[model samples]
Target: MKKLSVSILYAILSVAPIAGAQGDIAAQVVPQVLSRSPEEIRPWRAPVFADQSAALGYNESAFSIPKGMEKQVQFWIDVYTKYTTEQGVIHDAENVETVYEIVDLKGLKTEREKQKKVDEVKKIIAARLSTPEEGERLRFQLGQKDRMQDAIFYSGRYLEDMEKIFRDSKVPVELTRLAFVESSFNIMARSKVGASGIWQIMPYTARPYKMISPVVDKRNHPLEATKLAAKLLRQNYSMLESWPLAVTGYNHGPTGVLKMTKSYETRELGELIQNVRSRKSFGFASRNFYASFLAALEVEKNANKYYGSVVWSKPLPAQDLKLPVSVKYKEIVSWFDGDDSKAQVYNPHLTHKARKGHPIPAQTVISVPKDKYNVALISLARKDRTVAMEDKKGR
Candidate 1:
């Protein structure tokens, strides 16, 4: 198989490890500090930081970092906050805390050159493991740092709306931060396996929610995608009854997670990850899904501390108008006084066919600028009536 890019490695999908990265490498142990009390380790406990009230825009107590997984979570936190996209960490796959080196790929002219460098590091690590002096075996992993600053900046457009959707759906509003892990809040992000949008939902997963269709693929629309994601997460939680498992279920299917729970005879996420046999189905991505989420949550909540004084984009202001009749994309733009750019911005969900003069189906909720909503609605009504009269005359 071809080498996976660093960006592809971090997406919420189970991809193969980089080429020539052998298993059974040695782990370089790293020390960790345990600050929280045993009682406070529970997932439902209140925020550890007292000053940032409503820090995540929800009940901050619902999701805590699992005890044994703190190092893993911290590793991801560094990936998001400390490192940039130009750098990647070469580490033990199973033992994530045992990072061997941080490779700087900034000067590499091409992806092939970068992969060559990564493969060389992997071979050296594998050779060390082969030596009797190392005396331990491990699998190698390449961890890519996210473009978190950009993610956080883009998140400003939909964060409040996402929180509201999750809140109204009765799902944990903090789960909205999953976008940071999945696609770094990049609206146009599309995974190799066909997961799309800020939520990174697969087509199969989105079909039931009616999020993918001929006229529009709501998976690319931040707010619409959030509504579906909230519902899917709520269902997963309802089934698994554990936020860790439910969130993991977002990346690995809930059914697969349910099987792992049964196989391991435990609902404790840390235990399952530690004990379950790694395979093609439930590998690194599934194991680290929740840890990455916790990492994202912590990093995003304390964004200012990590990234000094971020100026977030304002929430887009628009009104949703349910169409009374099928209308072409240009017609909608006409209603917006021919500001095609603004019309496109407000309707990111429109598919290529819809944009190519095809009529958007009736009853579709079209977003229009809040200020222009009244006039747009009037214009649409007038156009619909005129079309009806023309059809009657033809008949």
Candidate 2:
């Protein structure tokens, strides 16, 4: 609609810059803004579109414009905006301005062009995998701030275990980097749809893998979750025959991705991304899955130059700890008072919400600091022997 153009014109002119070198800013700004990776652009773009659409009462459905209707709709809006009402119509400038605000749709072409550019860049980057070096650099760039930095460290730690799982299972090594985008490697990563963990496992899907529980969800246990993630990925890879689709399947689930494949009649991941609705069919998190992964890869690839060296932990040491007749939670805390902080790190499987009646099951596998392995083993043995003697006496 012409009014859309008028609105955009107002936006451009309002901030358009005043004369000379100042006006050059807007021209320069366009590419600079466009150049930001889609991840960087999305937070800025989503709200802008939401507000504009809200003002227009244009509810953006999963399918906004039907395949061919975009052009036809724009043409009609273009025609509608060019003419003004005459018979018994109001003449005040305010009235004209009000009508124009409500109806002018001139920038359909420019808006479409901007959207196309965004869609194009996302498609190009989504299918490609960054080299390991590129991944490291992109990791650092993603880690420039505290939030993403924590995500990077946590995710990197998870990846080490995930890589081991992949190697041991003989899965492709490229799949290891999938977590880089999944949650930037954050174990606590949760999507808008409530998908949780480094791999963004939804509760329903995680349940079958024995990851979800009122007492302890395995999804929070990184190593366990990674194993599950590998299993799911391997399964999907078998059928999808493409790493990108396999990755997409991780977000969409096997059934969801398969359905999209049937509907679109294409297995191309790049093509799937261009059709925004298809991406959303999997869930909100998956909609931008490839974009974030690519951004993280680019950042991790250049990490050292951007943010210096990152500490990659050796795989968290796994150990076994047997409780004495299922001790109370607070009692266990009291025992580790001096090193209480180590409890959660070593025992991520333990339910954090357990209270008086709820308690962690005995004999759970725990991850401990490598240095504490000797002490933990010796202590548990002594306790186990004591329990055995007490049980014999009772019998």
lDDT of each: 0.67, 0.45
lDDT, candidate 2, at 335: 38
Residue 113, candidate 2: alpha-carbon lDDT: 50
Top TM-score hit: 1
TM-score per model over all chains: 0.78, 0.55
Number of clashes in every candidate structure? 2, 32
What's model 1's lDDT at 336? 60
| Error at 317, model 1, angstroms | 3.3
- Candidate 2 Cα lDDT to native: 0.45
